[model samples]
Target: MTITDAPPGTRPARRRTIGTVLLWLLLLPGLCWTVIRLGGWEGHSPLVPLLAFTPYVAVGAWVPALIGLLTRRRLPGVVALLTAVALAACVLPRALPDLDKGLSRGVALHVMTSNMLFGGADAATIVTLVRENDVAVLAVQEFSPGAERSLAEAGLGDLLPYSQLSPEWGATGSGLYSRYPLTGTGTRINQGGFHQAYGVIQPDGAAPVLVESAHPLAPAGLDLLAGWAGDMAAEPRADPAGTARILLGDFNSTLDLAPLRTLIASGYRDAADTVGRGLVGTWGPYDGDPIPPVTIDHVLADTRIGVQDVTVHNVPRSDHRAVIAGLILPMAS
Candidate 1:
């Protein structure tokens, strides 16, 4: 065969080589995620906070694969597609849902959680939300001392007769208020060194529910990462189903963080995720903040409890939106 009739394998071979290189490069994030899932990075990694929104990353990975697939590049396209699938697999279970939309068959208890932004939230708005929603229990983070007066003046005390207040100077305060009687209540300091209050609230005629207001240090830098991890690590590893526990507040971490995942793995589930509202943003929308919205606030509960409804609401003056859930507690056996 003359040179002109030579086999045409060279061009195809070169194309395959280029495709292989592209495939490997495109899959690097997949490798990083594998390390992250295995290493269990504490709240220290900036990537840690971003991990909470893995659905976005997963979607981003699929675009290149789609392009290659349309162009008939088999190997590169298959590899990219596989990588995209892996990325989605890591996050979709939480983002997507198979939640039971059926109404709860148990006793109803409305709970609400909000970070009052160092006492800057509108007292009337807070009180109105509580009264209007028929909130049985409320947890507030950043409960500045000024909040005590504002809340009291706004009729919060009358609306929710029982409370455990740990009023601090600035963003170092936390409190729990309820219509139910709170017993075995106590004071504790959270990861950010803020005072926190927790206790058992027994509804008028229902079984007692263990409620806690949690606020871990925000995962801002490496210096605070250890503390953030420790903060989440210190929580009791009890099954919510066995005792009926409700843990809600500004966790300062998201579902993507390893520490937060660890906390949730211990038998509690975010109320928002329970009904597939996990992707909704709970922070931002304040006029001056540079950070975009994110779902940093949460309401976590035991497995045995039935979630009737879960929602996010605006608190007029606060930066973080409030989360409210209607939970069905198991009747007294």
Candidate 2:
């Protein structure tokens, strides 16, 4: 018989080889993703925006493992299992709460952050959340003059009277409102023209804390990625010896990105991650898109500050959720 008319036994061997080739093809992407993430090679243009989906990729990594095992390919199965475990190791910690002692002994300060989607978030709902949660400070991004008026009309002024507002006509606006008096208030406009409002608030029985409403430009395209990185890098680093600080709002980045992680490594801890709420998504689908949700908004507090709790809330007419953090500030010595 010719090669085209091979026997049935020979055909089985050919099928096995093809299956092995297919398994490798399926395994390549997951393997590359794990390596890039672990190696910190995701600092490039497209990878920066793409790595935001690592958590989902980590979940999908299991498919290769199962396929490898089902096909009885020992080497591929071993590699696939190891890749899944490695990816999980990188992702699973965000869900586990850290053992943070002495957090309950300090002065309590509750703060909330929200993005108004260019001034369209429900003002009343935001006010209700602030009132119900007893939020001491509120950081708003994409804040506009119309939003400022709507929030004031909704009685937000009655709740958080002290304010350092930079309400522009469009997406560049931002504001920081607090129940406590604000001092040294100003707005920092980043490279992409995104405004970040900041101030110092001294609560009763606590030392002064600097708070900033962070709204770095989104890396929507390759051209914006550098500006996004620059904005994140420009975020103030926490000094354990200096004034304690808190940054809350739409960071437009996830922890998976190297830039955000680098910023967090500078003496600040993610409040949600500290309390096991880090994996919870704060952005996506609120505007009725079919995209998967990701945790882009955050409450990053100084390492000296203690995180008590964190919760996310929904606001109408906005694509982002509001993140509230219960924090403990250091007492005045």
Candidate 3:
């Protein structure tokens, strides 16, 4: 054989070695993601934004496992298989409905939340969603003065009469409108200057419920990551021994993030997750960008609240899809 020519069996052996290397390269990222996710390292700068796409990564993880197995690399195949399983374990549960057998019977309340995209979403569509869904409460993010006027002109006042609004010029504003009278209305501004409007409402036969429109800053870049984490940390927790609470809007956080998970662990259930609709994407592509959809907007209710159903809907000119949650609130004690 010439210098450049391979010996009889060397070609096959070299090919195997290169294939093994490629297989390991393919397997390593998913393995690292699993480790970081399990270890709660997603709070770090790059990992913060990276973890938001964990669902997609989990779905793609099987490719490496399949490749390794078909290539007859037993160790790499087994490792890749285990890595896929671990990632899947972290993600698949969001698609399965939770067994909420302990939920108490009470008043039925329909709540809808949407991001107005800097007052750009079609107000008529939002009002129609509120009217047709029989929405008892509506929480809006990126609420602006123009949006409020548009919604008012769209006849939102006739249906939901009560309002607590923090209208601004940009994405910093938020508001809460309810069919029932709202008391203790106020706004909490996070470190990122996003407005979170809140109020207490008492439905006909149920206990008082504190509802808040949450709009944490998006972790789009390294500069905003700290603020995003801070805002998420500042979210009001559900008090089991106190008022039943609901927090909903553009959280700018996915269920895979540590901060959002911690918030949910603090006496709240993600409404969509409870009803097996959590995997549905609530943001992306609506603004005409070529981005994959992700579940960032959420309706988080106290554990005592029973989530009967949850759905996502489209709104023209908005980047986010509206999330509507049907909740059963416990009766007054």
Top lDDT model: 3
Q: How well does candidate 3 match the true structure in TM-score terms? A: 0.97
lDDT of 3 by residue, 153-231 (tens): 9999999999999999999999999999999999999999999999999999898999999999999899999999889
Candidate 1 local lDDT, 15-124, one digit each (tens): 66677677668766755664575467533666766676565677787876786688677866787787788777666665555466333676889999989998888889
Candidates 1 and 3 compared by lDDT, better number: 3
RMSD of each: 4.0, 1.5, 1.4
What TM-score would each prediction reach against the true structure? 0.87, 0.97, 0.97
| Worst window of 10 by summed lDDT in candidate 1 | 94-103
Error of model 2, residue 244, in angstroms? 0.7
Cα lDDT for residue 138, model 2? 99
Clashes of 2: 0
Tell me the lDDT of candidate 3: 0.92
lDDT of 3 at 148: 97
What's the true lDDT of residue 168 in model 2?
86
